[model samples]
Target: MAAFRSVLNVANSAKLALSSRTMASHPLAGLLGRLNHVAIATPDLEKSANFYKSLGAKVSEAVPQKEHGVYTVFVELPNSKIELLHPFGEKSPIQAFLNKNKDGGMHHICIEVRCIDEAVKAVRDKKIRTLGEKPKIGAHGKPVMFLHPKDCGGVLIELEQE
Candidate 1:
C-alpha cells in the first residue's frame, strides 16, 4: 500500500510538471516579443539584397561572419528586417540548407525577447532544444539563441535580446 501511494504521488507530480508549462497559451509566451527578422538562405547574397533594394527596401552591406561561416545582410522594413544569408567558409552551417534549397529560401525567423536567459529556460523546461550554445552574439550584436526546428513546427526559431 505504501509503495502504491508513492507511485501515485510521483505520477501526479509528473503530470503537474508537464501541465504547468503546457497549459493554454504556454508559460513561455510572455517571454517572446516582436518579430525581429525573417532569415533567407541565398546562394547569392548580393543578388538577393539587390532584389529587395529594387523593391525600395533598404538593404545593408554584406557582413561576413567567419566564426559562423556565413555572410549576412539585413533588408530593413518598417516593422522588421529580412536577413539574407550566404555561405562564407567551408563549414558553413547553411551549406546543407543551400544544397537542399538550390535557389535558397526562407530559413528562419528571429523574435525579440526581453531576457535571453529566461527565454532559454522556458523553452528548455518544455523539452525543446536550443541549437547551439545558450546564447551567442548575433548580427545585431545582441545575445541570441536558436531553437531546434523539430520542436518549433519545422521552422528554425531564433530568440534575440530585445
Candidate 2:
C-alpha cells in the first residue's frame, strides 16, 4: 500500500509539472486586458442615443468616421462603454449588418490588450484570422484590429491597444 501511494504521488506530480509548462508556453496568457466596449449597430443614431439617455446613461454626440464609413456615439457606463454605430457612407461596413438587423442589435465586442502588435502575432500563430493585415486607428483613437467572426465562435471581436 505504501509503494502504491508513492507511485500515485509521482504520477500526480508529473501531471502538475506538465500542466505548468503548457500554461507557461501559451503566448496569449496575460496578453488580453479589460473589456473596452460593446458595439451596437443602429439604424437611427439619434433614437439609439435617446434610448440610452432615457435609461440615465450619459451619451456622447455622433462622431463621423469617414475612414471607417460609420458614425459613432458613445454611451458612457460606470465600468465600460456602449458604442453606437450607424452607416456613414454608401459602402459602410455596418450597412450590411444593419440590413440584416433592421431594428439595431449588438454588433461586436471590443477587448483591450497590453500590446497590439504582440497580440496580433500571437493570434496569427494560433491560426486566428484577422480582418486586416495591420491594426487601424479605431474610434477611441487607439490601434485596433478585428478578428474573423467565424474563428471566434461567430462573434466579431475587436482587440484594442491599451
lDDT of each: 0.91, 0.95
Query: Which predicted model would earn the best TM-score?
Result: 2
Instruction: Give the range where candidate 2 is weakest over 10 consecutive residues by summed lDDT.
Output: 23-32
Question: Residue 2's C-alpha lDDT in candidate 1?
Answer: 100
Displacement of residue 88 (Cα, Å) in model 1 is: 0.9
Please, what are the lDDT tens digits per residue for candidate 2 over residues 1-162? 999999999999999999988977876668889999999999999999999999999999999999999999999999999999999999998999989988989999999999999999999999999999999999999999999999899999999999
RMSD (Cα, Å) for all candidates, in order, is 10.6, 5.0
Cα lDDT tens digits, model 1, 40-62, are 99998878988999999989999
Candidate 2: segments with Cα more than 4 A from true spot: 1-27
Q: For every model shown, what is its TM-score relative to the native structure?
A: 0.83, 0.84
Cand. 1 Cα-lDDT: 0.91
